[model samples]
Target: MGRVAVTGGTGTLGRTAVCALRAAGHDVVVMSRRTAPGLATADLLTGAGVEAAFTGADVVLHLATSRGTADRWQTQTVVDAVRETGGTARVVYTSIVGVDKVPSSYYRTKLRCEDLLHASGLRCAVVRVTQFHEFLGDFFASQRFSPVLLTPDVPVQPVHVRDAAAALVRVVSDDAVGRLPDVAGPQVLDGRTAARAYRDARGWHRPVLPVRLPGRAFRAYGAGHLCSPDAAVVDGVTFSGWLREQLGSAALT
Candidate 1:
């Protein structure tokens, strides 16, 4: 069994990856700022608590979010820590598809992080994935009061979080580097369809108002920047299925 370190180990995907690794009989170490049981605390931004966590680790799964300028610095810090502690460690970075096509600040930061990882001179695997099913809930919360769900005129291929996690696990277990084919949902669904599905599943009375999103970011999304049409390996529960499960559980309460 190999020693694996998972950053953002408390997050949805990270937690799932940790569980999968443990289930496979691998020694798993969770790295995050919050002190959870069996977790190694580390602040990637300042690199204050990473070395000890990385010690003896054979593989590092990087899933932390570097927001703003801190994103670049934290990525560098993590890369450096991996180099200093375990030079031969396999670094697996989870990234978003079409990071270069989108002009959003977050995507830009993700691209920067990818660049840093590539230049770090470590054995690395960069896996890009489409939007997650959880994004629907986040969107609902962000626009709760709106009579209609306003979304960009973009095509989305949303995948389940578990599927994304599994892909990352595979990358960590295999010999791969650079950009792997993007991972996406089984089917491509537009924003309007997704929003309506979300609303109907939750019994929300809001109508889905599809708006043409402006800017380079929106253009990139509309141009299918977040999906991989030719990707061979696809996994995960479908979005509709996941939504139904969530709504069903909520209704039972």
Candidate 2:
């Protein structure tokens, strides 16, 4: 195991990845904007102190993200720091599944980051992942005060961040040279079905309405581009199981 610097190390997936890497016996350093006892302050937005943080790192986990195309600049900063430091660290970038398919500005930014790494002339790997379990959970929670739960009239294969983090560890540990297979959940659930299940779990009895929003991105989502056909479903907790674990099994349908 070698030194690994994780950008956005305090984030949801970042925290899990850092733990997995450390448990795998790799030396890990967390890089964030705020300075902490064990974290190296490296703001990817401004490229501040990134070189020093990436120095001597065997692999750099690029987990930092931003809204819209700001991710493009952030990824460029990481690449530039790696080059400026004269380090040959393999960068493991965490990307979203269907970055190439979705027409959303955020997905475009993700694809741009991928392109930047491929063109940066550095050893890098890209792993696309499906929506996290928390993502769906948050959606239901957002509708807590609503009279009806508005679910998207589309299917989604959501994965647990813990499993995604574990896959990320494997990518970093192995010969990560290029784009790897997509990671996804074990099962795919429709909008209304998933919403009903989520409603039961939260003990919030409400009418679940599956609505279709008009947008290119929403249409892309409805087309199942987010759920890649070649995705490797990880053997981990499912969405319903995760809900039970979080909200208890008593409130389930």
Candidate 3:
């Protein structure tokens, strides 16, 4: 049981990670930008309170992420805080699979962050995972208002966030190993099929239309750059199974 500081501890994956760490008897310190009881306020985006949050931590689980261009800054700030604290805490970072291959700005920042962590001269481990089931759900939900759900033609293997969180905790508990095996869901399907599955799960009868995404990013996805079939460590929960649980009997096959 080590004293661990988890940045973005209140977020989707971070919440599950913090729970798992605490359940395993680790002294957990939650670091976020918001001030709340039992949680430390550390703005990774601004470098405020980071030193105090990471003080005396054995491991720093860096999980903060952004969808915009500020992603790299957030990660660099974490690295700076770790160096500034003068502590020997191992940094465990959660990343997405295929960041190196994807052409998106967010993914590129993630790749840069990986490089930053490697050159920081600290004990570090990076665990890359596929998109989460919840992320897909949200994505589909956002486009539901249209007459038809316009889905991308790319393939996706959506891992359960809880499973990803568990893998992260395991890495944190072990010796720091750089760039661990990629974690993914047990099944892979094209966006149309995935969207159909989600639609059925929610009992939404809207038709799902497959639309081709343009540019190098879409090409990379179409080329299966987002998938790591051989290197993927499969999690037990399939997207269908998780949807069934969430929607109860309403979820279809």
Model 3 misplaced stretches (Cα beyond 4 Å) = 231-235, 250-253
- Model 2 is weakest, by summed lDDT over 10 consecutive residues, at 228-237
Question: What TM-scores do the predictions have?
Answer: 0.92, 0.96, 0.94
Task: Give the backbone clash total of model 3.
Answer: 0
Local accuracy of candidate 3 as per-residue lDDT tens digits, 135-212: 888888897677788788988888888888888888888886588888887777788888888888777878888888
Residue 221, model 2: Cα distance from true site in angstroms:
0.6
Per-residue alpha-carbon lDDT of candidate 1 for residues 1-253, written as tens digits (9 for 90 to 100): 7899888888888888899888877899899898777889999877878989999998988887757888788778878898888598888888888888888999988998898888888988888888888886688668877777887667888788878877777777777888877788776778777777777777788777888856777788888888876762454566678887777722210
Per-candidate count of clashing residue pairs (backbone under 3 Å): 0, 0, 0
Best candidate, lDDT: 2
At residue 1, candidate 3 shows an lDDT of 88
For each candidate, the alpha-carbon lDDT, in order, equals 0.80, 0.88, 0.84
Q: Which pairs clash (backbone N, Cα, C closer than 3 Å) in model 3? A: none
Which ten-residue region of model 1 has the weakest summed lDDT?
A: 244-253
For model 3, what is the alpha-carbon lDDT of residue 53? 89
Error of 1 at 67 (Å): 1.4
